[model samples]
Target chain A: MFPFRVPGAAPIRPHGRAADEVGRLRRPFAVVVYLQSRDPAHVKAVERRTMDKPTHLIEFETMLLGRHLQLSAPRLRRNNQSLDRSAYTLLSRIRMEGPMSIGQLSEAFGLDASTLNRQTAAMLRAGLVERIPDPEGGIARKFRITEEGGRGLDAERSANISGLEKVMAAWEPEEVAAFAAYLKRLNTDIENLDGRPWPRP
Target chain B: MFPFRVPGAAPIRPHGRAADEVGRLRRPFAVVVYLQSRDPAHVKAVERRTMDKPTHLIEFETMLLGRHLQLSAPRLRRNNQSLDRSAYTLLSRIRMEGPMSIGQLSEAFGLDASTLNRQTAAMLRAGLVERIPDPEGGIARKFRITEEGGRGLDAERSANISGLEKVMAAWEPEEVAAFAAYLKRLNTDIENLDGRPWPRP
Candidate 1:
């Protein structure tokens, strides 16, 4: 049902060999487009190349796309973007997996302890999460999602999921099920590689 | 070939209406999944819906997907999401037809001149663009894309186009051509409405 169009502007001309080499960097769009192009074998070849050079994916994402996407950070932070996602992720984890130690949360996300502390500090400030004295008293505090956090997470979840379902109304039940299954696996695979335990909801 | 595999994890308990509603909010992973699943027609709908609810899209993106993307304001000042697609129109105009004043840029984008001025100010600092002396000696300055900016733009274009090319490799050529055509129309429509003359080059 998608109506495709050619981009009207002039294609960026590759200036030389450097451009050609740099242009081959892995992009998420390339994966999607190749799937649409219906050349799974070519995609398999490209995927093999991508797997062989993990650094290209890292470099392309970090050096280029990451740079451009991130340029908006300061302006975005002053708005709600900074506040919501972390808050939601923290709360989601808490809701799904009971109370967690600050260290546990830190390890789960592979974030520095200090960064986790700082992030949780905000949650504590908002009363979206609470810091409790550890009975073990080992210099670590236990954190739990609060009712406020639950309420906020619920609202956010409701809004986001509703939109997706409406958009997917045209899809067959089997298609939706398949996509959802893939999504969960992808999420799990990503987390597993990062060494995070699966959430137990 | 996407090696389709069944998830080892438990079936994701459908959150019923609540989860679907919440999915509409456009978090990064969710957006990737949602947008990726969509056909070009569906994408146009999503983009239209996103633009129609500009405040929502801005809030949704700013709060949800934008942060994890970890994009900085300065970085975004250089480039916004290609996912938005329409954003490319302004950049395209600047590259093809600029050396235009802030007022002109604002007029072309149909945004508040002050907002466009703010955007250009960041571009100026990043040296992605520059402000030249207005030959007419007005208080306003004329802006043009810098060489570095052009390089950055080209890099992003290559990333996105190449990325899509890979993703849809499994689709037929006609399917690929169709979506490309729609994208071209959408880009042109935005530029035409936004007040920039189409660039010959």
Candidate 2:
């Protein structure tokens, strides 16, 4: 799923739950008898139709997911653990990759320099991050996560995990792990295509 | 995954990909043999430790996924076919469940009446939806998709599908279907928990 594999990254394999879901959805629709004919055109048409389906479903489900996030995220914020999403993500990036200048953040996140400047300024005002002279003595200042920032990110992350745990309460551990792996893969591929790979722990 | 299954909803089975990834993550660390000994304390300790892991990964990756969406969604808007996301989703809901009043949308999405009012008002201005007297002659006016809205939704949806196709270009059909199923299940569960229960087509 990732363009460059981590040296010892875990491998994700296909599982049966998805097969069962897909199979059940298909069974009520039609019974397919594979064509024994050697006609390439007929085979190609069938392949094309099959290929179109999953992608379509993925597109629709993701749209709904965005809606789900819209609804759930606000509810999550009623907890004192709430950290605005951009701030949380920015803190996470700094936590993972250490302090970085706005320019570096812009490059890593594909954001405009102005946007990063505004975002970092907000982080500074919120005490989530503080500016420091470059550790390597570069002219540009870098933003570093403060202890407060770390606590806030950790707290918000814990809340998020708790929410997911509630959602997946009935899932088997293997199912939870597999779904996570798939999400990681999907994000990695998106990062890969955008040429802005996010660092993983 | 859902509190209530649709009359004939497909069943999602747990598949191997997740197990493989989880197993690999466990390897290079330690191996455990299930103790035949009847010590409940040891068994409980092992179970607790095992339970804590994958949930953490899922939480972190989901946060990262949010970051990716922030980065990618704007780029997606550059297309002429672009429809604002809320507008697309609103049109889609109306398309699926038929035109609905502000109260119904608020209930279904858990949004404040003021928020849905503002959203529908904007959607009205954009010509993506129109106000109609409730078909049942109810006093509350409902929003219905315009033909233009339908066209915009379809165009944006196709673009979304194309983008996902690029992301999953190397994925097997089964993998794509499974991931979609996972997403569907996840969203359904979230909706169920929220008591929103988004209609599925």
Candidate 3:
């Protein structure tokens, strides 16, 4: 017995049956089938089957990552630095790559120019980054990480690292390496899909 | 030359200098040291060294996960479902586990009661879930997923899974399974750290 009715699992057979009648009849049946099954063993078996599917595994990973972000966002800030995840990431990127134009940052992050403009403008107001002449003498100015921004980024990064370290302390080094490689490959694929692949540093 | 400055790489030496002077002097030195090294070969070496350390690997994974969520949140919604990541997750949980109380959800999610209340209330107003008498005849009422909720959850889940599948398409089945297992383990460890492990289905 399936624990939950798989949505749209039933084919609507219109053979000698009115389409409207099929729709009307199947709706209540679907709901009933979905609500009636509450057996734990069935749920477990269904969950196990779902977990075995690659698509389900991917969905579960996405959901887990989103949940972890929501759960940890509040605790991620350090020393009154209210940098959201995006801000923290932007600062870290700028700090590592030195000054970069908004276009460059946009391309690197796979975000649009308008989004980067708003984010960088906010960062500028917060003194996280400063607009400066492009080091390569380009037409557009570049944004450079400020000292305060570096400190905030470092503090937050360290705090997050410490938290992750504690969580992963039991894992072997090889396990960590394999996970990281997979994650990097995943992100790279995501970036490629968005057509804004970040260049290898 | 490091692709990123390994934050907190400087050894804390309080041997002979005034602590304040050392603090003031080391600040610039650290920044300069971090920025001036731009040799690609050196960067690769440093990256390899960093990857070998489990703490750094964990930090990289955390940062990548955070970045991925920030990037994907906008695309995860379906039509006007308008459910944030947390709401979608909550609805999915209810749909899977049948009716559950706010307290139970809070405990399972490792979130506070007030947060779950606000989330569930929004879900209730949105008709994604309804308050129901506990099936087990407990004092606390439970939340049940509405038919509409299940539909929305299915839509969003399918969209996310499609995206993930595209990302993982080139990966072997075994690779996907290994990555999924690792991710599950990591999430389990994180939940355990918070002392609110979700019961396995």
DockQ of each: 0.07, 0.41, 0.25
**Residue B175, candidate 3: alpha-carbon lDDT:** 82
lDDT against true structure, model 3: 0.67
| Alpha-carbon runs more than 4 Å astray in model 2 | A1-47, A74-81, B1-47, B73-81
- TM-score (chain B) for candidate 1 is 0.50
Best by DockQ: 2
Model 2 residue-pair collision total = 7
Question: lDDT by residue for model 1 over B34-151, one digit each (tens)?
Answer: 3354355665554444323222222233232223333222222233533222233345567877578867866555457777776777677767778788877877778877887787
Docking verdict class for candidate 1: incorrect
Candidate 2 at A104: error in angstroms? 1.3
- Candidate with the greatest TM-score versus the true structure: 2
Question: For model 3, how does the per-residue alpha-carbon lDDT over A97-167 read when each residue is reduced to its tens digit?
Answer: 88999888877876799999999999999988899998888999999999999988988777777667677
Sorted by TM-score, highest first, which candidate order results?
A: 2, 3, 1
lDDT of 3 by residue, B125-181 (tens): 988899999999999999999998888788877767766776677886568878888
List, residue by residue over B1-201, the lDDT tens digit for candidate 2: 322333443422222223333343342221132122135565455435644547888777777777755457556334765777778888899988888999989887778899889888998998989999999999999999999888888888877777777888888766887888888898888877777787777
In Å, residue A36's CA in model 2 sits off its true spot by 13
- My TM-score estimates for the predictions, one after another, are 0.44, 0.78, 0.66
Off by over 4 Å in 3: A1-53, A73-82, A100-107, A110-118, A133-142, A199-201, B1-52, B73-83, B133-142
